[model samples]
Target: MSTWTSRAALAGAALALSACTEQETGAAAPREVVVARGAVLVAAPPGYCVDRTALRDAEEGSFALLASCASLDPNADGPSAQPAILTVTVSGRDPETTPPRAEALAAAAPEAVLATRQRGALALVHLGDGGDAVLPGGDPRHWRGATGTGGRVVALALYAPRESPLAGAAGGDLMAALAARIEARAPATVAAAPPQARSGDGLRATLARLFN
Candidate 1:
């Protein structure tokens, strides 16, 4: 968990900033990206699409950057439940491949933890003031999660702009969906659905509730 975010921090921020700069980009809706010669499928949630320019892959691993199709390309149209940036990293399952440890990161950078929970094999963390250690200028409150699936461990994060609703609980739900979606795409696992509804709120409202 730490290794994934620690490595992608700078790259994630850059990808987000670049996407924001391109008011008009991407020629088509992206397809599921294959990684590691059929080891993993970078399946993005519905209404979202991968930013191919931000993709990094090797023979057995990959990092994918995703955002609303519209954000990637104005001409592309899709029902994005929340406007935010997302990242997914897939590596061969190993001893180091464990569930996300929000409390662990909190131990190292308590200021970055908003809330954290572990559910069975999956672990998730809500982050605030994580800009220093996570995504700078991102919604201080972002969401990250990790879990093992289909012989590999998947790590993913969701970053919203301050005013975006995804800064709320919906962010966690989204990351979980990303994890589940990846497992569903694995050759061994049965196919599952990818989707979401919507949320209506912003960072200030969330902060008030948290600090109040």
Candidate 2:
């Protein structure tokens, strides 16, 4: 080929590559949110938000995170029904083996215990009638689950107004669903820490907090 033609072809190829790079650089990235002691994560659900400000520190070994689906839209003018709350708690480094759902419920000294049942994939221990005020604000319902996998154990609970759609069988099913989402990424040894993948600034910061 002629020198002029070869030069022209190479220049065109370079321009095309630069354009591709620019397009990729400007593309939006996927969104993600972490939950349940950072053991479970899912793509940030649309219209759902997490409230981190009220994270409960029951003790050095225990903490809870709450997520809500409350509507933030201002245009809708109508009665605002109570929003559903999903609460997840993690209990770390407990010397005692994880307790059975029944045992945990009995230990709580609840005013009354209800029959144990499976909802979705989780067997839940009903804490008590939602009227007991075990939850803040005298909430109507509370339920608990103890899930262990890969030698890591986490106890999860959900507190909601009795009127919530997720208050009954639905709540149990939701608890089961969330529990199943826990990732078994617990490091088997100190030397086996997972390598951090380079990510965008936001993801990098989120992961730092999660893993640290």
Candidate 3:
């Protein structure tokens, strides 16, 4: 038997709910869902300090926005099934390949299916299957793709279970809304540096290196 897992699955539920209500109007409705004020601080991966205030937890699931003054994971070799900075991942069993399965899953739900890319044996799907009128980078799922300034910002990812209460709820607008909340709270800039360079020798040395 094949297994499948997606970190975005939980977050995708919010998209399903939002998509259900917004399909016709193409506008997300106000949610009765009460969100806590300020961002919730969570321990981020080493070498990166995430804005916990960027986190938005709802009954559907949760979304977190991260800002790295330095690199989130300088040595992150490639995508892993495990959760890492700024990436939503899913791993499990399925007869189909990653992209096809991801496409089918997104289609079944109210998600906005974005493009798919193959990473070795895995297929990575970049989607905007949530609420929020404007994502960090405009909707990649759209035909035109991103434009101008939207091209520079990193994309905010969403996840959803193949079959869950949140799946196919709405057009995934709520998920977008959740993403918007996170984006609204994210830092304006993430400094760039050479791949092998460190922000500060001490800071780099003390930083916990993940993805071993």
Candidate 4:
């Protein structure tokens, strides 16, 4: 498929799967999560925590929702809590395939890419209004990054209210920071759940869950 086609396909799939939820991941520290058949280990950045109640591990892939630690745990005094909703999606990697490259992603959807930056080993793309092919209409502005983990491509996305750090130029730095800290662990057994890819009703629910 063409680059644009691949990019759209990915976004459409993610959009479709956004609404469907999953079981809690039990308690864990530093918020380390094994997901996507173990293709990715989502480690919450400082002051943030994984929302166990909002996770998906199924045939479609692994999805983790992240929020300020203070929001998830009333007792925690998250001094650095960021005003943003972060998500990580781990697309199961085929042994025969390589992780998506930074340049490749930028190239895939040029019209939407506002800026591309190389952060450590991560290449981040800042999307313009309605630009992110990953989650359209959810946020006018967002950041996206991809990296290889456990033979899979870990997709990172950040959405924040206007005037928030995650919605400005600093977004790339945040994305890179989170990317550098993420690690890959042993593949966990796939959950016996239905496909996260859902119907039109689910899509509307997803938009509400995300934008509201």
Which candidate achieves the best lDDT against the true structure? 1
C-alpha lDDT (0 to 100) for residue 195 of candidate 1: 16
Error of 3 at 51 (Å): 1.3
- Give the distance in Å from residue 39's predicted Cα in candidate 3 to where it truly belongs: 21
* Full ranking by TM-score: 1, 4, 2, 3
User: Which runs of model 1 end up more than 4 angstroms from their true locations?
Assistant: 1-5, 20-26, 95-110, 132-136, 184-212
Overall lDDT per candidate, in order of appearance = 0.62, 0.41, 0.27, 0.58
Clashing residue pairs in all predictions, respectively, total 0, 1, 33, 0
Most TM-score-accurate candidate: 1
Task: Pick the winner on TM-score between candidates 2 and 3.
Answer: 2
lDDT of 4 by residue, 1-212 (tens): 12322332344335333422322233332366767655456777788876665667743456777766655655555466765667776664444334455676676553478888765556677777643444443456777677655544566777666667678787777777778777865434323322343334332233222222
Off by over 4 Å in 2: 1-48, 55-62, 71-82, 94-96, 118-123, 130-139, 186-212
lDDT of 1 by residue, 124-180 (tens): 878776643455555677776666655455666777877677887888888877776
Q: Give the clash total for candidate 1.
A: 0
Q: What is the Cα-based TM-score of model 1? A: 0.72
The better-scoring model by lDDT among 2 and 4 is 4
Model 3, runs deviating above 4 Å: 1-48, 56-63, 70-100, 109-114, 118-123, 127-132, 136-212
Alpha-carbon RMSD to native, per candidate? 10.9, 20.5, 17.8, 9.0
